[model samples]
Target: MSSPTPPPPREVLPWSRFGEAARELARTVADSGWMPDLVIAVARGGLVPAGAVAYALDVKAMGTMNVEFYTGVDQTLGEPLVLPPLLDTSALAGARVLVVDDVADSGRTLELVMQRLRAGERPPAQARSAVLYTKPRSVIEPDYTWHRTERWISFPWSALPPVTATATDGA
Candidate 1:
């Protein structure tokens, strides 16, 4: 027997809109007069948006922190787990930092990242967060957000299933 199909996403963020959202989020940050010296992306989901925002803000320094939280659609682990290839917090010292994520849904991941970034002897002088979307129930509200939605979101980068060897065999 086959597993049940997941329901369609309530909101679909196309590639075009993703670009716009990144720019808008960056604008919010710029308007606030807090330009970051470095941009740290919450890897996997946040990589794309972080790059876009960094480009928009002309921030040359960038880093990534890999965190695994959501297991599947609307599914999650008890808490977020930081994956390997960890970011070097040394670079954050005395620099204005911006943490970028695709969405601040549960806010656990963001909270964990923020804590880790702010801990230790060397921490950023000032740290802020940015996201394309934020849920109402989020534990931490990001400094800059492009939209707020409670329903499932189909991000352009994650909308499709992973490409397997079989899928590429004939192509």
Candidate 2:
């Protein structure tokens, strides 16, 4: 048997549109009028977008939960996995939360967070997911999205290629 064929690379270039894109995404959430009491970011990628949305909604409360999905360019685990130390949900008791991620590639990671927030002993008042971009293949649709694209994203924070191992290790 042969290894499954890897997907073709889909590079997205967003040179100067980072802030604009983030603000646009935030607007979508505000327009929806869900009005979260707190903003919870899926760390790494969601950090910026979540902050922007929190500000747009005038939601001062914010938190972050880290999860790992992508391992390398065009590579990912069969399922998105939660990474700890998870965000402290104690403050989220009875608070409506807007969960933010950069993109929803398969939607599993978003689903995990949503379930976690909703199932805890002191579950939140409500929880919703949002993203800057959404792929058609996502298993779960987000409550708010600014754009839809199938291409692998080129977020401003992660646009540059990683430095070679040799350079980092001084080999």
lDDT of each: 0.93, 0.84
Given candidate 2, what's the lDDT at residue 102? 91
**Considering every candidate listed, which one attains the maximal lDDT?**
1
Candidate 1 residue-wise lDDT, 1-171, digit = tens: 999998865878999788888999999999998899999999889999999999999999999999999988889999999999988898778999999999999999999999899894799999899999999989998999999999888899998899777755985
What TM-scores do the predictions have?
A: 0.93, 0.85
Write one digit per residue (lDDT tens) for candidate 2, span 1-171. 999999767646474776787788778777776688889999888998898778877889899999888887668888777888877777788888899999998888888889888888788988999998898998889999888998888887787776777866978
- Candidate 2 Cα RMSD (Å): 3.8
Model 2 misplaced regions, further than 4 Å: 1-15, 163-171
